[model samples]
Target: MAHYRASESKREQFRRYLEKAGVMDGLTNVLVALYEATEKPNDALDFIKQHLGPGADSTDAEGSRVELSELQHKYDLLLEENKELKNRLLQYEPAADHRGVE
Candidate 1:
């Protein structure tokens, strides 16, 4: 049918576009790597993201995650320290009711 042919043409064109852009090859390589892994990753999507996303290194991604967590913990500690310092400083300040207009 004419409609079937048109659909097939569009599909073929899209396929060629993917090939031209190397998307097919890149995806194929990623899939092959996944297939060849000795032990399957617990989270396949995360594995795909690590291999296919920017920087494309699982160790780098993991290191970044660890660094982020450490920095977050440091930030929390700093916040608590800041709050304590502010409270200590307030102890020496005059009460609000003591202020008078000059």
Candidate 2:
């Protein structure tokens, strides 16, 4: 009975330590996000890493990815439009005088 109590006490101490360090809250939030994800990630470990890995302070990994993709598409479209506009402008601009002779 003494041995059992000792083990239980150790476990409790460890749980408190985790809670005090904010590990419990962080993990709980991550798990809840994963559970609510519409499209499950193929790699569960990778998903966790993306949310909890280095430089990862946010929990909405999926949302971030989607936003990034949308931004990239918009940037591409804008770049193409800018190129077209520049080409059109070039057609009207006066040609540069290349001859140095007066």
Candidate 3:
């Protein structure tokens, strides 16, 4: 029982961090709490229905999921862009190469 409580505490801490980081909204917070409580997504959906009042509709949940997906997509694109930029910069010729100063 102590271990279960500790795990629950950790999950709560993670949830709080996620909220404070602005990564999710109140409805999504309830969704995540449901997820943590049941470990099954269907159970999480049910929990959301019970706990999230009128905000547990498919549209809102889908919107949150889409936002997370889009953020991930943007992050991937930025990483690729940064890598390409770094490679391009690394390929530049030094001034010494043109002057033959060595």
Using lDDT as the measure, the top candidate is 1
Question: For candidate 2, what is the lDDT?
Answer: 0.89
Candidate order by TM-score, decreasing, is 1, 2, 3
Clashes of 3: 0
> Candidate 3: what lDDT?
0.78
RMSD of each: 4.9, 8.8, 12.8
lDDT: the better of candidates 1 and 3: 1
lDDT of 1 by residue, 1-102 (tens): 999999999999999999999989989989899999999999988878877899787688899999999999999999999999989988998777997878
lDDT measured at residue 45 in model 1 versus the true structure, 0 to 100? 85
Q: Per-residue lDDT tens digits of candidate 2, residues 62-94?
A: 778889999999999999999999899988885
Of candidates 2 and 1, the better by lDDT: 1
The superposed Cα distance between candidate 1 and the true structure at residue 75, in angstroms, equals: 0.6
* lDDT of candidates 1 onward, in order: 0.92, 0.89, 0.78
